[model samples]
Target: MWRESSNIGRNQTSSYYVDNTLKHSFSNKTTAKQKSNDLKMPQPDEPYYCSQQIQIPPALPDILKQFTKAAIRTQPKDVLGWSAAYFRALANGETPPVKERLEMPVATQKTDTGLTPGLLRILNKQLGPRKTVDLNIIEEKWKDLALPKEQFDELVRIGGFGGTIEWLRYFALGCSALGENITDAMKTVCEILTADPDGGPSRIPFPLFKDLYTYLAKVDGEISQEHINEVTSHLQYYVDKQEGYVQPRNFTSPDCPKLS
Candidate 1:
């Protein structure tokens, strides 16, 4: 009887140990599964957060944005130097220096005109020995060219005696627009104006040359008769000699014809 009771107790202890082990394992598996399901997934709109914090600012102002875009487009070589100069100018309450405006290259073939450097030298000599002349005189002479008033003023402000040469160039361009061959006309006009009293190349009187040029443009139908009338009306004294001929008293001398 004692041997049988001992065997039964041993069997019960073994069964208890096996049941405890299985229960513990099941509990652990259940806990792990619960943890996996409880964990939350992130929404699409939310930004991912790692260890670091990032700060984003609002949009920039329109003017500042435009300037930044322009700078990016230009792509200057020395960005830091440009920034320094820009800041310095701003601190000094002055405008920063900007790059010059680039003009598109014209591909038209250039025809040789008598307005060469040699002719320019002669014209300059005729204007007198002075390096500069009254800007008003040039402005008055070419007023009929009909360039923008502001642009003409700016040119006069910047260009000294050199402005006269620029005016002639501009006049040639204007005449070209009217279907007139300005180079040939300029050659003829210069020859006529420089013709001398004693049969030598002489200094042309500026006022007389201006009057003759105005007449020539009108006669060639480059400018309207109404335009000529308007110009003559502005003069203090003018005489109409015949059709397509006019004389300004100040330009007429004893030697030069009254009608130019």
Candidate 2:
């Protein structure tokens, strides 16, 4: 009987030990799994794919921001007019008239103070009766004239002289005092008007001529009624006789007489 009791006791002890061992193994496995899950957690510095946070883009440069604002505020309504003024400023080796300080000069008669007949004569002699005057010629003549830079700039600004058309008109108006024998003047103006931007013969749209006339009339009282009449008549002739545009040939041909 004693021997049987000892065997039973041994079995119970063995069973208890196995159960304790299993429990310890299971606890260790659970702790390892928990540690692995903790390591997988995202750090504060790392952005998670599932995160709802949004990053803002960097701001524009101060200069760029200012330029954008200025552009928005000062956008021109008349693109052609603006272009003319801009180009004229560039041709004169001055800053473009788009700046706020360079407002369009007042179109009063007092503004015509410096445009003397002598100056006009000088320009006429330089341009001559050429069918197409080079832009470089006009620019060089402008410098040779040695007119006050400030005054000339003011005239250009007020006249809204944007391109070759305005430059020609400015000289023509100044020369109007010489009477109607403006053959060379008419030819030069026509050349500039009809010449292509890339070089070669092109047509001058009537609307541009009209715009130029209107602007010139407002700026200079010395521009005679005959000048206005002649310009209108020529434009009408082109519309009726030629196509809606005036080509270089039209100006060079005998049909279009000198601006008398």
Candidate 3:
């Protein structure tokens, strides 16, 4: 009887130990899984794809940095008149009147100012005799002139109504005509923008131009006058502000850089 009691007691103890061991194993596995899951989870504040704080540097020049000061220092009315004249010519599809050509000082003349008689002749020959010209031609000719940067600076000062957006667009056009080396200029602008985070007066123009060019380039054939008007109307808002200011809406595309 005592032996029977001992056997029964031993069996009970063995059964309890087995059950406790299984419970412990399951609890340990569940704890490990939960810890692994916690490690894999992302923090609430972290960005899933790219950080919002990561900014694309401004792709522009030092001249743009002092744009307000440069603008304030110079006579805006003269600049506005120049942009208006070009805008009006573009709007009317008329030949821009040849203003009395002034010889740029030798230092400035080395750059293609788009105001030169040779450039004017090229403009008339290609675009037909119109008072307002398509600004894209400036891009087409930048490389052939041998001094694109200087010429681009002149175009920025004179064309598109004085916006960073317009100047960048015009610059992009020039870069496209010149080919990939143009990207170096674009990177320069990006560097400038990155350095100066403030929406400084120096405008970024390529982003908008690429957008316009892509839409314009995709047309099956010649761009119709209607198309010209639509583009001009959109561009005018910025141009009217300064013969060169480019609109922000023009740069709202990720594919703009590839448009060239």
Can you tell me which runs of candidate 3 are displaced by over 4 Å?
Answer: 1-6, 25-148, 151-260
Candidate 1 clashes: the total is 0
lDDT of 1 by residue, 1-260 (tens): 89999999999999999999999999999999989878857458977777557554554466467456534543434566555544554567644322222223223324322122222222333332343445564453223222245645543333333433534433333333322353344333443345345344343444544554564554455666565554545432333332223332323345332222
lDDT tens digits, residue span 37-95, model 3: 98896668954666776675674455345443433432223555534544455467755
- Return the candidate ranking by TM-score, descending: 2, 1, 3
**TM-score for each of the candidates:** 0.21, 0.29, 0.20
lDDT of residue 155 for candidate 3: 46
Q: Model-by-model lDDT, in order?
A: 0.44, 0.53, 0.44
Which residue runs of candidate 2 sit more than 4 Å off their true CA positions? 1-148, 154-199, 214-223, 251-257
- Total clashes in model 2, counting residue pairs 3 or more apart in sequence or in different chains: 2
Ranking by lDDT: 2, 3, 1
Write candidate 2's Cα lDDT for 143-219 as tens digits. Answer: 54344466556555655555454345556454332233344334334444454653565567766555545444545
**Clash count per candidate:** 0, 2, 36
- The better candidate by TM-score, 2 or 3, is 2
Deviation (Å) of 176 in candidate 3: 19
Off by over 4 Å in 1: 40-260
